[model samples]
Target chain A: MLYLVGLGLHDEKDVTVRGMEAIKGSERVYLEAYTSILGVGKERLEAFYGKEVVVADRDMVEMDSDEILRDADKVDVAFLVVGDPFGATTHSDLLLRADALSVPYTVIHNASVMNAVGALGLALYNYGQTVSIPFFTDSWRPDSWLERVRENLRLGLHTLCLLDIKVKEQSEENLARGRKIFEPPRYMSVPCAISQLLSLLEEEGQTPAEASSDDAVALNPATTLAISASRVGAPSQRFVSGTLEELSKLDEEAFGGPLHSFVIVGRRFHALERDFAVRWAVDKDNWNQVSNGVYKVRD
Target chain B: MLYLVGLGLHDEKDVTVRGMEAIKGSERVYLEAYTSILGVGKERLEAFYGKEVVVADRDMVEMDSDEILRDADKVDVAFLVVGDPFGATTHSDLLLRADALSVPYTVIHNASVMNAVGALGLALYNYGQTVSIPFFTDSWRPDSWLERVRENLRLGLHTLCLLDIKVKEQSEENLARGRKIFEPPRYMSVPCAISQLLSLLEEEGQTPAEASSDDAVALNPATTLAISASRVGAPSQRFVSGTLEELSKLDEEAFGGPLHSFVIVGRRFHALERDFAVRWAVDKDNWNQVSNGVYKVRD
Candidate 1:
């Protein structure tokens, strides 16, 4: 049997008990490391599981997954994901391939960024489509996500923005030379995301779609409410709420470290939501001013 | 410190190692029972933790959450929720109250229906705002959720419908008499939710909004696609896909037991999603026909 286990957010101890059982029962274990990483290193996981785990990179998982699944019908093979198994579409590809080989598989679900974003006091029911923000290069600046944020704002729904992470990536020159060199891993910080968002708002000016509806709103750098959450689900996780103008000015040391996510708050704010969010605001006076001017109080 | 722990979707064994540690070290352990439940009973949880687990009902948690935080500053108190602590807003109220009472707290999140719905082969990024479908009473047959589904379809986004769960509810007559008696728990089945969706579609004739857009779609009882997922994170979890009409006609035995959720498929159905979802179709021929007729296939 093939087992797709989830190592929940944070350290090795975050994995569920059933996940431990799957790891213990499997004849071979492989950790899919390209998509996301646990807070702790593989050595810590090995010490916790008391078993050696094979690390499967993006190439092996994408090009040679058959090797990972070999003899799975006869022996149990466990493929561990950093979050829930279905967080990315690539995991589903592996599961479907297992079906074609006539190997039965089980999915052990756990918390993922999709749900963990609710840790910032935003209701999951009020969220629209989830979007990902990639690092902006000099020539490749993708600001299409701003329109998605606008669409969500049109419906009074919050948009959860997943910051990008570049891990084990090769440069163009290295790929041509067939070198096995890799760059240092980089995780998008909340300030970088906020700056990109500000750039989008400035670039999309005067081309903004429908701005007349009573409940309709747009992303204004100074007036739009925003939130940044980093290292969520860990005990030391930090949440900082401010306007885009306030957040885009922060340095790297302003908040916690990597794997940060930014959120564009919707116009339909409730008193309860405001009450909870006020505690984390960089400027409570600015938050209240924006809440009074732009947000539509539900109750 | 107050610890808000999440007992993930399945049995007692689904709790994380950190959760177990928190339970073992806490002076008082209270399970929040009204928001949702674990597959196993309190006896099983008590046996696993080797301590008595206090069942905190909705009244106690909402009305007098301060009492739950009593002495939390002096000693550790663990209040567990079935899913993540933020799945329901009431948990936030408790946390805010803790902050007001000078009781520091930590949150341990787990799998929730919000993210667990991705198990049905749907992409989490494609989901719109989630809507809850309450059981329709004879006098109050509310269908506002149908408009929410339409709004989601207008944006080519899938809708995650949370089925209603009523537990330990007092009858109106009994409540009027000031009696503390409770009624048997009622969990909404997939068939019941599909029936309600069909009823709404039948009632909402011709009042539909702008349908001239190329991708705009409406919920047709005979053609629109739907999926029913039950007991999601458990090993025996089941997922079945069909049209509104086909799923509405199914008996209770067609799905697993309680805590079922329904999804209304949107227009943008990718080939990968279709391939994965086709395995759970009630009728493959009907699925293909509907796929060809209604779904906007995204290659």
Candidate 2:
């Protein structure tokens, strides 16, 4: 049996009973580490589950996946993901592989940041397509996500920007020379994502020279209401709301830790949502001024 | 402290370790019973946690919310929800009420149908705004969701249509005459949802004089590819994919059980998603015909 278990957001205690059972009973346990990370490390999960866990990086999962599935037809092999196993495409590929190999698998579901972002006092139903904001390189800066945000705006729906996490990634020098040296892990912070988004808007000619006065419209740097949330689904989860420019100028330390996510507020707000947003705002007075004053609302 | 614990999708065993601990340690445990339901009953939850779990229906939650939060400032109280605590707006209301009463709370996250829908071979990021398909009566057939689906189609993103579950609902006569008699719970099946959607499109004149030749776009009823999944996170989970017209013709038993969710495939497709969809398809031949033949692909 091949068990694709989700170690729900936060620490080891977030693992469900079924997932824990899969880990304890499996002959081999592999923690998928590249796509996302929990607050606790592999050692913490090891101590909690009382089993040795092998950390599977990008190479091991993408290239050496058959090793993880070896003997799975005879014994239980648990492949653990940070959140829900289906958050990334790699897990789907693995499921197909298991089907081809005739190894039946079960998915033990857990909360991912995709759903956990609702903790910021936003209703899940109001969100549009979820997008990822990657770390901008000196040479490679992708602006395709800008159009997605615009599309969400056009439809009057909020967009969830899942910040990127680069784990065990090598520098250009190492990759070009076929070396194995890896750079330190990078977790995109809320402020960094805001700044990158602002720059991308400018590059795409979406950000006007003079920002719009409307405080609620997204893609407008000066006034668009946005949220910066970190450590969601954890005990220390924190969320702050402000305009895009203000969020971009704030220090990353204000958000506390990694595994952050950002939200671009939609133009269409339910009456209850306005109240909810105010209650969860960073500065209630400022939120009130912006939301009640100039937040351009559509139906 | 009030613990808003999420009893994740499917069964009692799906609860996280932290959520379990919270349930055990709390002085009072209340299982929220209106918005959604777990596969198991309150008895199963009580047996697993070894605590008396009181079921809080819509009346208890919306009308008597103060009862749930009473004395929480002094004693630990656990209010359990079926999925992630924030999937419904009522949970947010409870949080606000707690805030009004100066009660501090913690949210223990768990899997929700919002993210669990990804297991059906579709990427999470590709989904557009999630919409609810409420049960329609002879008089009230809300078509607002139709516009949302159309917007998703316009943006080239898939739409996740969450079927409605009516729990502890009173009949109109009973409600008007001040009676407490409740109707049996009704969970909208996949076929029911599809039939409702098709009728709605026709009612709105979006069905056209004749159905389009296309098999990929939504709102056309005939050719739009869709997926019907049931018990997404459970051992007995089942999924069937076909064009909207064919899916509407399928019996409810095809999906096996309740807690079903439906997905309307987007006009755009990644090549990998095509293969994944085929692998998970109920009839791979028909899926290929719709996808490979006239299915529109937009970047």
Candidate 3:
């Protein structure tokens, strides 16, 4: 049997009791490492589970999945994911492969950022289609996500922007020459994402429709309320709510580490939700000023 | 410290190792039992952790919370929730009470239906604002959720409709007479939800706006595609996708048991998602005809 176990969001202990039991009973355990990172190291997980975990990078999981599924029909082999097994499309693809190979599998579910972002006091039901913000290169910068955010805003739904993390990425030159060398890992921070968003707006300013009418754009950085959260589901997690302009100018040290997420607050706000979210603001007075100005609707 | 530990979707074993450790170390463990149900009883969880578990109902949690948090400042107290601790607003209110009392707390996150619904092969990012369907009565049938569904459809986003569960609820007469008598639990099944939705559409036909134009309405029972899932994350889980009209007539026994969810498929369909969803259709040929006719967009 092939076990797709979720390691929750934090350290080794985040794995469910059922997941632990499966791992202990498995002959081989593989950790898919590229999609997300855990707070603890591989060795810490090995020490806790008393099993050597093979680290599977993107190439291995995407290309050599057969090897991971090898002997699974006879023995229990565990493939561990940092979040829920189905959090990423690659893991779902793996499940499809297992079905094709006639290998029975069990998925042990855990918390993913898709749901964990509710910790920000925003109603999960109020969120619209989530968007991912990739690191903008000089040659490649896409602003398609802006449309999604706009649609969400039009419907008074919160937008969760999942900041990108580039791990073991190769440069264009390296990829062209087929070099195996990888660059240092880079995790997108809140300020970086805000800057990209601001640039997109600046670019939109040049467009005829945007220049002719201010009402055409849904979001204005100076007035729009947003929340910047870092290391959610971790003990040291921090969240700050304010206007986009204020968030864009926020100090890098305010959000201490990797895995930052941003939420563009929608127009609809329940009094309770607003009060709860205000408690996490970097500047509570400013948050109230901007939020009240932007979100006039009340429950 | 107060620990809000999540018992992931299924049985007692679904609790994380960290949650188990917290339960074992706690002087008192209370399971919040109103928002969602667990496959196992309190006794099973108690036996698994070798600790006395207290079942905290809605009254105990809302009215008698002080008793639950009594001496929590000095003793380790664990409040176990069926899914992620913050899945419901009540839990967040409890957290606020803890804060008011200056009690430090830790959240042990686990799977919630908000994320676990990804088992339907739909991208988590593609879902819009989730709506809940309450049991319809002769006089209290509100169809506000139809507007949310229409908005999601306009944005080409999937809608996850959470079915309501009435557990330990008192009848109007009993409540008026101040009696403690409770009615038997009633979990809204897939068929019931579909019937309610269809009825809502039928009611819309009488409205002036809906009567004037057929294209203004977003959902059609005969053509709109949807997925019915039951006992998700449990071993006996089942999923069947088909047109709304077809699912409205689905066998009650086909879903197995309670905790059923319905996903109204949107216009956006990645070819892969369409293929994956079709595999679980009750009638593959009919599903293909309906889904293709409705969700024509392909990526």
List candidate 1 segments past 4 Å from native: A206-216, B206-216
Residue range A1-299, candidate 3, lDDT tens digits: 99989899888999999999999999999999998999889999999999999999999998999999998999999999998987755376777888899999998889888888888778888888999998899889988898898888877788999999988999889999999999999999999999999888887764425543533234777667888878877888888888888888888788988889889988766667777778777678877776666576454
Q: What is the lDDT of residue A222 in candidate 2?
A: 62
Candidate 3: what's its TM-score on chain B? 0.95
Write one digit per residue (lDDT tens) for candidate 2, span B17-49: 999999999999999888888888899988999
Clashing pairs in 3: none
Residue B82 miss distance in model 3 (angstroms): 1.0
Q: Residue-wise lDDT of candidate 2 within A18-125, one digit each (tens)?
A: 899999999999999888888998999999999999999888988988999999999999999998898755377787888889999999999988888888777788
Residue B182 of model 2, lDDT score: 92
TM-score of 3: 0.95
* Cα error of candidate 3 at position B21, Å: 1.4
lDDT accuracy of residue B22 in candidate 2: 93
| lDDT for each residue of candidate 3 in B1-299, tens digit (9 for 90 to 100) | 89999898989999999889989999999999998998878889889999988999999999988888888889999999988887754376777788888888888889998888888888887888999999999789978888898888777788999999999999999999999999999999999999998887787664524533433235767677898878878888888998888888877887878899989988766767777788798889887776566566444
List the lowest-lDDT window of 10 residues for candidate 2 chain A.
A209-218
Candidate 3 — which residues are off by over 4 angstroms?
Answer: A206-217, A297-299, B206-217, B297-299
Question: DockQ of each model against the real complex?
Answer: 0.71, 0.73, 0.65
lDDT of 3 at B242: 88
- Pitting candidate 1 against candidate 3, the one with the higher TM-score is 1
Query: Could you tell me which residue pairs clash in candidate 2?
Result: none
lDDT, candidates in the order shown: 0.83, 0.83, 0.84
To one decimal place, how large is model 1's interface RMSD in Å?
Answer: 1.3
